[model samples]
Target chain A: MINPINIGSIDDIDEGEAKVIPSDETGTGEDIAVFHAEDGNFYALNDNCTHETASLADGWIEGTEVECPIHAAKFCLKKGTALCMPATQDARTHKVEVSGNDLLLYPNVPAEPVEA
Target chain B: MSDCTSHTSEANASIGRMSRPEAFTQNIDVSTLVDSDGGLIDRSIYTETSIYAQEQRRIFARSWLFLAHTSQFKKPGDFFTTFMGEDPIIVTMDKTKTIRAYLNSCRHRGVRLCRADAGATKMFTCTYHGWSFDLAGALQSVPNEKAYPEDFDRKQWGLIEVPNVQSYKGLIFGNWDKDAQSLEENLGDMRYYMDAMLDRDPEGTEVMGGVMKWTLEGNWKLAAEQFATDWYHVNMSHASALMVLSPTGRGPKAEIAATPGRQFGSENGHGAGFPTHPKSRFDARPVHEYYDYEALRERLGDAAVEGPMTTGHATVFPNFSYLPVNGSIRVWHPKGPDKMEVWAWVLVDKSMPDEVKDAQRLYNLRTFGPSGIFEADDGENWSEIQAISHGFVTNNVPLNFQMGIGSERNDGTYPGQTSELYSDAAGRAFYRHWSKQMNTPAWHERTEQA
Candidate 1:
């Protein structure tokens, strides 16, 4: 089982901006990007864009969505839905939770499903 | 009535131009074309122009045609443009909160008045000569009115109103024949089955969005009959779709001949087939999961819940058909002998949550929309039938509908004739009703099974 890693205080990442956790600490080989979205909530997805070799962490965050840096493709940060073009597949998502003042990331664990 | 625009009377003008012609239908006999009891049907019923022309007058003109739903008109001035057979119609709610329909032509030059499919309008103005009509089809104004003779009465120039207009459970229907039966009388025992989709909740039902229309090269009856009857086709026709949906080969296995459900033929030619399917097979999750069984039971008795309620296709006589499970209602309009225009709408309980309504809409689109998988299969079959029947030799051949022919029965449990799910009794019954309407010239002379 993968343990929950403390990603420090919620104040560490600004709203509408994202930060990346290196693959070595994640132990899953893939880098994880943590987003503090415009909805004032924390979300995590695999750092690499599904369309090409680009970091989603560096893309622009627009209202709970992140535009990929290289191709301009967009994805829904909450459910990792591929919102628009050059990308047809969704990026892998990891569960994230805010407990008190700290942000905890459960590596390799899937988040609650998109509301039906 | 004198036509104001035309000076010469058409009857007096045609006196020397032409002689009276024999009836066009003198050659084609409807009796030999369809032997519903015998299970034999002629191919020309699906491909002949003469027979189709007869249908426009005999079937479309006289029957209670489903035009629109009540939810479409939230307030006054809300109007929807549709067709009864080939003629265009406008259905609108006036300021009185009363619904009315009119023949969608300007009284001035016979030009189509309502160009848009649906919109809010207090009045319809003709783009040709600027003739204006109110929501209730009254002629409010006519351009150059004083230029004509003093006998040019504006009151006589109103939009032609439909003879009969009525609504049953928020589903509106219009009839051109004034002396024909009432909407409730025409619906007959079919109303029992219709309640399966419409009356499940006291909260009422509403059509989701504007209709999705598309043309297909097929006879309208082919589509209608498929809905009314033909459960036998699904196990073969939609096998590929079922197979794809069931990657593990554990898909819906509601076998036809052995299933406990029933196929029914109503008193007024409506047909229904409800084949049992396991809940594990597949269903519109938002609709099924959220249904209040106790509420439904309270609103509807055991006869409705346990009776021959439709879980599949159903038709109301001529061409109104709906899928109770898929939540789609459609009308197959006869475009020509070899063509049809399909108008479809998605419906759901008005009380459902927005998310559930959205899910129901998506489910209906994936299952019965113009490009839906099952719809594609049904379309291919209908179009191919029309294509192959064009041959003289092929057209002469009679198709067999002999599956359980003599087995149709009524146990007094349900309202109409019924047989096992796999039987073609309902199809035969539908054709039989079509033949009766075609052969009889007068509505009063026609025989209706009680």
Candidate 2:
């Protein structure tokens, strides 16, 4: 269980854009990137790129994927899946919910649970 | 005096050369280490921190350094990033179409201003603090104008500008010292050789898309000297690569012992070595020879193309080096005493057909790119030399440079002190001019034989 932290309104991030949620607020000891995907839905992933030392929040947000700016390794924003070469591991995804106009971020909570 | 000096040096604006490399190091302490007079080079010059720091101050900072080709700056607000001795710089063409180079650091907090390798933008807004600078590097906007003190003047704080910038033909160069001599004066006889590569098509040249960059653990001079003067190593060091390049025949060691070749060193430490035979081609690859010699005969005389000494390797003083065979232009940006970062660009004639241009790109990469065959051979030698310099015993050994020492002559065949086919005359000249520049603190007090 995790406490929901209010991360401004949905209007704070525009379509095809992303905003960085600071590390201290994430409770996971890593920075979180709340991306407003082009699909008109918001998704959250760990900000640090798994390939090299670069912030994923500063990367390009495509339809449902984000490309790492450092080496252009694309990752699936929906499942935080690394979708290209040079990046083998998946990015950690965080749970975020849009309630009316307010965007709520759940710290330390996984967005999806995989099969054991 | 030989006829080469008598005839050429009568009008020779360039001083010390292959024959007499110690032209400017008459009174310097570094001369003892690089005893060009006796043909012995001290090993410490490659690994000493004090000598390396002095090189940064006197050599890289004062010499005319290569910037960027003119093709990258066709538009008004176009810009690109390059380094001047490890100091990042932005070369741009402002609204007036005037070319300029400025330090890449933001004036406000000294953070890097432009992070992109290259792109055109009207304004560069600092990612930190959002301080904006216009195309000419003028401070344009401050995010919070009201928060600043009343006396804070925006005009006073602009991106620091490189003191001098100029171009030779299409090649642009920058200098940190304003008092340094003109690029032409520094280039001297080396320009005559450069014309062979740059003036071939009359359509001029353009760098093929993309730059190839990589790092190696080696002192910068180790590579620069080889490019400028050490073609003698090509047969030995790159023997395996040559075998792969030309399987059966002797390759471009083509009658090397039997052929007539000349090694030349100019006033400002520039050096080149090439065989004088008209048909002596380094790479047997025919696609690289697409230049129309008859069409160029109108601009350049028959002698220029016929005797293609300019077809070989050459280096301009400190670090700018180029090879005509694969059309690779590169600058060895010195990282420290034992490391260098190589930034290379593949240049081609603008009028070349698409396929030929593509072939040039491939050949350029296959031969000299990061993983290139010849590049690998060269890197290993430089790296091994650097690694061995770490030993206290090996560090004190004086390397032999006595190949064709007394053979430097001027028969009026090529240019200044065209020594024997295989010689360290150019290397001696290189270290001589290096010691001279390292010793002279003031630009004006520096003397030339002329």
Best by lDDT: 1
lDDT of each residue in B298-355, candidate 2, tens digit only: 6676655554323478888889898877788899989999999999999887888888
Which residue segments of model 1 deviate by more than 4 Å?
Answer: A1-116, B1-28, B247-250, B254-258, B277-281, B306-310, B443-450
- Of the candidates shown, which would achieve the greatest TM-score relative to the real structure? 1
True contacts kept of 2: 0.00
Q: B61-162, model 1: which lDDT tens digit per residue?
A: 788898998889989889999999998999888888777888898878888988999987657777777677877677765555679898987766777777
Worst 10 residues of 2 chain A by lDDT: A107-116
lDDT for A97 in candidate 2 is 93
Candidate 2 structure, TM-score to reference = 0.72
Worst 10-residue stretch by lDDT in candidate 2 chain B?
B1-10
lDDT, candidate 1, residue B124?
79
Best-fitting candidate, measured by DockQ?
2
